[model samples]
Target chain A: MSDTGQHSHDHTPRPDQDGPPSYYQAMETAVRELLIEKGVVTAEEVRAAVEAMDARSPAQGARVVARAWSDPKFKARLLKDGSAACAELGIDMGPTHLVVVANGDKLHNVIVCTLCSCYPRFLIGLPPDWYKARAYRSRVVREPRAVLGEFGTEIPDDWEVRVHDSTADMRYMVLPRRPEGTEGWSEEQLAGLVTRDCMIGVTLPKSP
Target chain B: MTARFGPGDRVRVRWAHPPGHIRTPYYVRGKTGVIERICGSFRDPEELAYARDGQPERPLYRVHFDRRTLWPDDQGRAKDGVEVEIFEPWLEPADAAMEGGT
Candidate 1:
């Protein structure tokens, strides 16, 4: 055997020793440490909050909205007032109030937080990585058709595409019209049709 | 905060330019349209991202635009229109309502 560490040829570091810490891990550690030092929040409380937050996914909200689209009575209630309407479906609007816009054959809806990334978190879970990206937020309002076209969505020549601006107090969600092939589908099947981009008004729902 | 504009109200998006600010896509600035709906109020992300949440809530409006108005080059169908959200601050009432009500 060679004298240099048994003549090993590999130079790459081991899994546990390789690479710099991730930004997420670093930020989390820093925030936790600071909180602990300041006594603003305990490590146990932080862990509990993170666990609870993770459990609050957007799937439930999507299901409620999808079911409402299939039910005329619920759709009517949603149109009347989304906050109360969501409650009827057992989905809490929570701290952020939301408005649900229904899209039809002649009318289409698109949502953007022109100033920032104001989104309907309750209905769609976390906004997609792209939604928070500068490329999308900056280009969406100015180039609606182009941006949507990139996502494989094309509004009809005669159909109108409406853009909803999300601001400080108000958040918006698009209730895309049910696709033709999905008739008689169950809520579970229908939920699959609801995409995060669709709810954000970037694309239409796909057939179940 | 209650919505300031209503369905069918005509308004224009105010041109905003901030140093090193990238926001509210440029093509839509100065475009005129009618309000379609009021999406409710929440913490403005622009403020929140800047770590300033003390500001009051701002009203969000859904505004509609004719396709012809947005894209002047006449190649596609004539009746196409687009709707986008605008804050109350970005809009001013237009002289007449379009097909929808204000």
Candidate 2:
């Protein structure tokens, strides 16, 4: 209902380029066949893994953001112990530790996997094509504000841009600041404002 | 595991050229930063690359770097910075000169 007045900006940043396919495909096929022949794993298992990643979406993360915005206690728990907080919220990421970084008056956090596409798939679904692109992986680290500008997010010149390179061992989700004017908005109403890009630190949550 | 550094501690990542998988970003190597928080130790990603269990787990610190030090040519905000998770073995205490860096 509240969504009617505003748009859901998932940012669905389309993939702008193709990956090195032939080399990776050949290597992947060879290794996969060998693994199957050796009985290390089954084709079904591989398919299931893909399916699991596909099953995840931004809504899982949006719920967490909505609750944190309305409930300060939950926000504290989410920031202090992200895994435990998500578990309580029923967003199961299956042991991959999640870290919630908060944006403030002077600082903002953006996520990028520099070495590879290491993401919190259980929480926010597949990495966008742009997310896995060389342009993003390389530029976001060196020039964050510039990359964010491509997404139409203009940060004030005074605020510090803290880019988080999700290299290994942990995954990150930006807890965007709740928009103003909806002082009495419901959690579902608030959830509508939170978008995938907002969680990625490229854009702010749209106002209702 | 005990944390060698905490939030606000100044540190520098050594620019080691490991032959295999590494989680540290190249842009951050040799750059000095302030410790944001200590992400508890886990399997070392380098060892994990070779399929070896990253045992004797290493502490990973969230280090904050100055935007200028990372991209010297950039004309962005002076207060802007970058935060990256770096394993303990790859980092060391920054010299006093580095501690004074923005």
Candidate 3:
């Protein structure tokens, strides 16, 4: 197996920027060792979970956006049932509600988890550091349009913006409005424009 | 499992501060909003966090609150809103007074 891109951040005790394990690291180590010692979960299982996390990336979500752009029926299905529609494209969404809020002419959508960092790992992989930062977690819910603006996305004043706070089990994705001037583009070509931020609703899909 | 609130139902989040692993945010406690969608049933996260079975699964809903309601100092132009995932136990029927006051 390739060692590149084979690292997991979820629950992984990473060293601080100053180059030492923080208290959280020590705590995580202790907890992990104890859990393993009790036979609750094997060390092998932990390694496998890390590998699975490593395998996931934004490309999975991009594939779904590309399919939706090319197929209207599929777009409708995705908006109606995100998990099932993703499954149709061979994506295995785990045990959580994958809610897709479509971006329309009159409305925009953004997502955040105020309590903790709960991202759609199956679709878009690990979230960026900014997404999990304390400031972002606190500010995004209160001022989403402003947050989007910080990302260089300018939404008109007229469009109603909706900030989705993922307080619990449900995970949300912003189905960005399809860009113009790309009539009859192949799904592969369309997928190129979908960035992780675009899928997250901070940015729009790039135009041709 | 039957759902207590459907889409468009106006509800008030009960303001309680019971200890240990709450999914509800502190800012949203005792807030009022409308149901955006039903999220089906799941074991209570509060109980699940403690390794409890969380028997009798509870229904979760996507609740939408007006931005002005959530943050009184919001500077947005129009009626931009915030939607949150809330379990059934935390929500109750919203009254006009509660909506306007809180």
Candidate No. with top TM-score: 3
Selected candidate, larger DockQ, 1 vs 2: 2
Q: Model 3 chain A: which ten-residue window has the lowest total lDDT?
A: A1-10
Cα-lDDT of candidate 1: 0.71
The iRMS of model 3 comes to: 0.9
Task: Tell me the tens digit of each residue's lDDT in model 2 across A1-208.
Answer: 5668678867888997776669889899999999999999999999998898888899999999999999999999999988889999887879788999999888889998988888878898987899889999898887788899999988888888998888767899999998889799999999999999899898999988
| Most accurate candidate by lDDT | 3
The residue ranges of model 1 lying beyond 4 angstroms of the native Cα positions read A1-32, A181-183, B1-5, B15-29, B38-60, B67-90, B96-102
lDDT (Cα, 0-100) at A192 in candidate 3: 92
Interface RMSD of each: 4.0, 1.1, 0.9
Q: How would you encode candidate 3's per-residue C-alpha lDDT over A1-208 as one tens digit per residue?
A: 5567867545867767776788999899999999999999999999999999889999999999989988999999998899999999999998757999999988888888888899999898999999999999998887787788999998889888888899888888888888898788898998999999988889888878
- Per-residue alpha-carbon lDDT of candidate 2 for residues B34-56, written as tens digits (9 for 90 to 100): 99888899888788889999887
Cα-based lDDT at residue A39, candidate 3:
100
Model 2 error, position B74 (Å): 2.7
Residue B11 alpha-carbon offset, candidate 2, angstroms: 0.6
Task: Write candidate 3's Cα lDDT for B16-42 as tens digits.
Answer: 889899999877788888999998898
lDDT against the true structure, each candidate: 0.71, 0.87, 0.87
